[model samples]
Target chain A: MRHSGYQIWLLTLSLAAATLGAIVYATGMGHIAVPASEIIRVIAARVTSNPALLAGIDPVFPFVVFDVRLPRILTSTLVGGGLAMSGVIYQGILLNPLADPYTLGVSSGAAFGAALALLANLTMMGHFSVPLFAFGGAALTLLVVLYLSSFNGQISANTLILSGVIVGAILAAGISFLKYLADEQVAVIIFWLMGSFASRTWLDVTVVAMAVVFGLGLSFFYARDLNILSLGSRSADTLGVESGRVRWILLLGASLVTAVCVSVSGIIGFIGLIVPHLMRFLVGPDNRKLLPVSILAGALLLLVADTVTRAVLPVEVPIGVLTALIGGPFFCVIFRKRQRRVA
Target chain B: MSATSGFGLSGVSFDYGTTPALVDLDLCLPPGKFYGIVGPNGCGKTTFLDMLTGSKSPDRGSVTFMDRPVAEYRRRDLARLVALVPQDFGIDFAYTVQEVVLMGRHPYIGRFASPGAEDWRQVDAAMAAIGISHFKDRFVNELSGGEKQRVVVARALAQQTQFLLFDEATSSLDVQYTMQIFNVARNLVRGEGRTVIAVIHNLNLAAAYCDEIIFMQAGKVVACGPSDSVLESSMIKKVFGVESRVEVDDFSKTKQISFRYWS
Candidate 1:
């Protein structure tokens, strides 16, 4: 349903408030029974630098909230938002709502890069090598997919999807070959591919944060062009958008967002696709509004998903596995719906 | 308006690989006129529109707007000068009609800026001019073909350009909608002094609305003049390979045609 401005603003405000609540609740989770009240008190004390609020709090509680949980939860939220933001760009540029980083093969490219780094034990950039390589792989894949799909200057949706499928298939084979070469270290590769946020450090948060921020800056900068682009390339160009240049910039920026998120958290899938779908229903198709709401909604969805795996669930499931579990069925529903529309 | 006030094409040619779509075509389109490009299928009518609208540049010559090469104009600047109503108006995403029309303001608004009050005023005026203000809040994807076509026209109207190109914009419509669209284009030209160009398949509609007509055959213009003169029986037989009779409808004071397959 199309919402009026009042309704949209109300929904955005509520989502923002809900995200804050989720963060507090999520931080109090895992083995420790620290209530949300304690989470708030500890955070307040730390921020104000006053001993009065922390007078009676357990010393371990501050470390738990500030050190252990904050980084991981913050990282998950930012990564989730970043992925969803990228999804909006992909869907807008490709003019197909089903298009996402995963569907476009960007995530697989990042996965392949990380796997290659793992196999080679390439520590050239030390701990930074994996993400650097992942970024390289994703950037390279984007160029190849664009080149393969483009004819003259126009990139058709069908050609792009087909090229992505072919490139992704070949990359999947390359990843498997790397796994075989990994031999003893294949287990590590397998685990990373599954995706997780456990034991995430500030460095992980910092890197993903920087990439996502830069990405968001680009998204906001080109949000108007993206809105025009949804009308298709020829129309968009006539409507005053440099469709080719905008598509390349936005696609590369979004792919870089995906690359960083995947490098940090592995191939977490559906948050990108599902969050935008949900937000579109709430906010309609204008990217300027859809984008900000999608970012918040995506962060909340991923944070809740991670929380369930981290604390509420009896068995720890990989974040990637859980998103795919939910996202796969969701994808089928969307696919079936689109098929019905066509039929 | 000076010599540069309208569109000019000289030595224009385009090809799909070895097959030429437009060949060595030179034409002048004046301001404040309603012009129609007419030809049979694959006769470079659409290709000519594509070249004029800058969707495709001429391979061998220059297309100028106001005496300046269209290629030299920035995309946004060109968009401000000319707006196109494409043949297909179907969009996959659901944006409200108001939102779709508001996109015309893109050329005037900065990348970081939102549509301010003046922009909305133009949008409302355009929608009002097209008589679609009742469905302003409705999703564009849900509109009927005629209504959507009107919405697309409203978008171009909202662009507030000096020129409008209709690339078979009414080809999918019924006879009623086609007449309605032409009436709107004619009104724009007569009332607002806009340069309106349409690539039309229906000779009757073109004859009824267009002040001037260009007839193309085999990637070249065979005849061009006032519609009554340009769309005669001889031109019809030679260009479209059809036998036709042209008449000036007394009541409407416009050219009309009756056609049969060539014997």
Candidate 2:
């Protein structure tokens, strides 16, 4: 269970390299197949401000790589990383192996908001309206969960999760009601709820990138505290961690990351829950190592899934459905193996 | 009112909602001695330790260490001065013993910095002191109850605090492991000039090793003094509502108590 610093660094670097490789390889796969060399050359030409590298490639290839593929790929990658990072924080703070980014009902809140926006056909804010509403709903849900769980200024894990379940059930009902009201536009809401990465713009990538990067920094800064927190709040307090304050800060950070990612990507379910568990098995339970590894692994996993759907499959399936279909069975296997070991 | 060393509590009172856990308790504990807080169930022994460690702030009065209010110190600063080995220590993850022990150095290590050579040295010395260096790399969850408790004690030792508090830490251990932990605490006091206070349920074990004993009853201190003076038959009768015989051991010259019950 103990990995040396050298081993952790090597694993982290390897994962990072693999993620970069996956991004390039996935970008090249499409209806008009761009080669990996062409993808790399286009990216290098753009980054180095040297159009010379682009001279030999097809003129449409750079546009396809940058406008068509790169944005969707990067957005999915960042969203995956964000969700997985949030998952690590949530599990660490709540001290539950089953905890994920959506454990606090953030996804339910976001889905409800999106469904409402869709039913109302509110385009006042243009493309940003749905995501804005989704983010607002998610933030509000977290606040309610925190308020419900806190007693005498202390937030216990059990009560917090209980409140989340209670609130999430109510919001799920609300989302169904919105779907019922949609009637003719119901398919729009249903497709969105299923989630997809098609036609994702650069704006989505930028917003997700900011949130994920900031979240990574925040989670890493408190990674050691998160490790101590697994010892329970009392032990964490005795070790100089102001458990309540640190928990609040981390909860907010993780929730914000989750809210933004869900707003952009609809409801990608299992990346958050599964990636952290998988990375913990590899890097051990140290959050300092687990956080970085999970981020890279999540990005790689989701990018591969999205690529398989967008290019490998005869028809594109919604990214959310694909992840759940795959992740549900995978998670069950992990659970069964763990149960046997514990027994 | 302002003692320069050790812990000082004056008129300290705390309540969980309407039920008082500690009531109007005033006490001063000096340095470099092993003190035991002995009381029956529902008494305020654990709460008192909570106040001393600054984990709980007294609702009414004041709790101080080194002439300053404990509530005023930053958590990390206070952690450098006091460490507590709590009851019911359980880790949910598969953290290695060395990793768990090294967590005691959290206050000393920087936010962005990993444990340095000095931190590792202290951690190694602590594990070695508790004779757990052999399993330092073993997962803590895989260890037995006694082994886990030793690891916890090693963590506290790595903290290197002047004040060490144990809240019924040996309540779950076998007698041999209990003696092992108590021996470690005794060495910390007699050999290193550190203060060790433990809330002990086993009055016999408390009487055996503690330099002084404080008996609590109904959320108030009934008696506090040297072991021989405070651990008499009458004090036991008053605090525990039971009859007991107390005597000085022939070999160790320490007070020993035996309880009597209805046949």
Q: Which candidate number would show the highest TM-score if scored against the true structure? A: 1
Model 1 lDDT per residue over A254-282, tens place: 98899889988989987878989988987
Query: Global CA lDDT of candidate 1, please?
Result: 0.87
Candidate lDDT (C-alpha), each: 0.87, 0.86
TM-scores for the candidates:
0.93, 0.93
- Model 1 misplacement above 4 A: A37-56, A125-128, A143-163
Error of 2 at A137 (Å): 3.3
Cα distance off (Å), candidate 2, residue A166:
4.3
Off by over 4 Å in 2: A1-3, A48-53, A114-136, A139-166, A333-343, B1-4
Over A1-343, each residue of candidate 2 has an lDDT whose tens digit, in order, gives 4467899899999999999999998988889899998898999999999999998799999999999999999999999999899889888987767667566787778777766776787799987677667767877888898799889655665577689789989998888888888888888677877888877899989888988888988998889899999988888888999988999889878877887787777788878889998788778998988999999999999999999999999999999999889877876786576567657
